[model samples]
Target: MRVTTTHQLYTARLPNGGAAVMDVRSGRGQWQHLNSTAALLWNQVIEGADLSKAANRLTATLAAQGAEEAVVRADLAALVSHLRALGLLAASPAPAPDPAPMHVREVLPAHTRLSLPDRAAGLLALATALFLLRCTPIRAAIAAARLVARLPLRPAAPERADQLFAAVRRVRSAWPGRAACLEESLACSFAAALRGRAVTWVIGARTAPAGAHAWNETHGNQVIGQDPEDRIWPYAPALRVRHGRNK
Candidate 1:
């Protein structure tokens, strides 16, 4: 026979004063609110007790104070139903066992340089597209855009990184060209590169004497080469990740 053990739950402080309890067995997607009484019961349940034992303990305490056991039982039953719906509880033939804690590194992927247009214009266009996508308020749209932005540009695939790079370089080198033309070309290039990936490009000054630099990042979280936090910017918001070398 298979024996089940009660899974351990963890709590976190929400932005508000209330606490949020997450069921480890169900992943971060499963969360619930915990009041003082409910918290006490949850703790008891984690200590190798069954849900029925926890409910009885609560009922007993309430009954000792001249409370109605029937009402308490009803309330506990309702609470259990809600928790089960939220994936915080599970029933099996044997006592449930606690799951081993997962490490952040185990879940996160290793960093690498994405294949992108060799030309600067293509990268700029991709960045602009990402910025526009992030501006939208709809969560699903925003999430989809972000995912696309994070995808690394693969020159080996359908896109030619060299041609794109040359185009961008020409535009950037032509210092006296019309500003509008330059901006439009750059935007198009950036948008193309970022079509389905989650990535952010940083365009700004690195230091007082070194002049400006442009780079890209994944998830706007990790940069490829430079130390993201150490870099300083004089213009535009410092995009999410710090400046760094592409890995």
Candidate 2:
């Protein structure tokens, strides 16, 4: 079976140009480090290179770069064994069922409904916020707000979180300006904060097309605002905003 990444973990590039794997599902925040060579192998596997292909590519890349071939082979083997042991790389992928249509309210909790206020006033407010964020230096705009968000703020209930996110998305759809992924994520998180909820904001990038995307997640590590996973699932976490701090 070919090794592949599991969706249960988050992958990020460390400052030293290696990969850091964190299993947020455990809620413990433990991290495993991978050196540059291993990180490249991680990326290759995520790109669907099987065991042999990944190894050959790793060897070839190192040899071309004038690294010792024997050392490269040993390191590659060790990295593979370590990844398998950690369960980050799997032998086979689990079948992913098709996602439901986006606008189907049934997919969300049945109890939560968008109220008249949410559909109108809340929507307007969200649109305005998105517009302002788009026009301003968003990071600077978020500076003051993030201070309050980091103070162990209370979380919005699931129903409310869903409603706020829906409002942001609804407004974004009608926006005449360019509301990119970062803009949308910022607007959603800001709107949620105004309603007294603090969510984790994430910005990530993938190398294939070499682009970035943004989204939000709850403090409990549940994804909030939607992201197009197909384009982003292989992305390494780049910047993260949480508890009023950007990391």
Model 2 error, position 167 (Å): 1.0
Candidate 1 local lDDT, 1-247, one digit each (tens): 2222232344432222233453434321234565555656665665557778788988999889898999978877887888788666653211212211211111112232334533443446534533443444222222333344344553221123223333443434454533332133234335445443223433322223333333333331222223235444321211221112111
List the candidate 1 regions with Cα displacement exceeding 4 Å: 1-8, 12-19, 24-30, 91-247
Per-residue CA lDDT of model 2 for 118-141, tens digit only, reads 556446545655655655544343
Model 2 whole-model lDDT (C-alpha atoms): 0.58
lDDT of each: 0.40, 0.58
Query: At residue 56, what lDDT does model 2 achieve?
Result: 90
Q: Looking at model 1, how many pairs of residues clash?
A: 40
Count of clashing residue pairs in every prediction: 40, 1
Q: Model 2 off-target regions past 4 Å?
A: 1-112, 117-132, 142-145, 227-231, 244-247
How close is every model to the real structure, measured as TM-score?
Answer: 0.31, 0.51
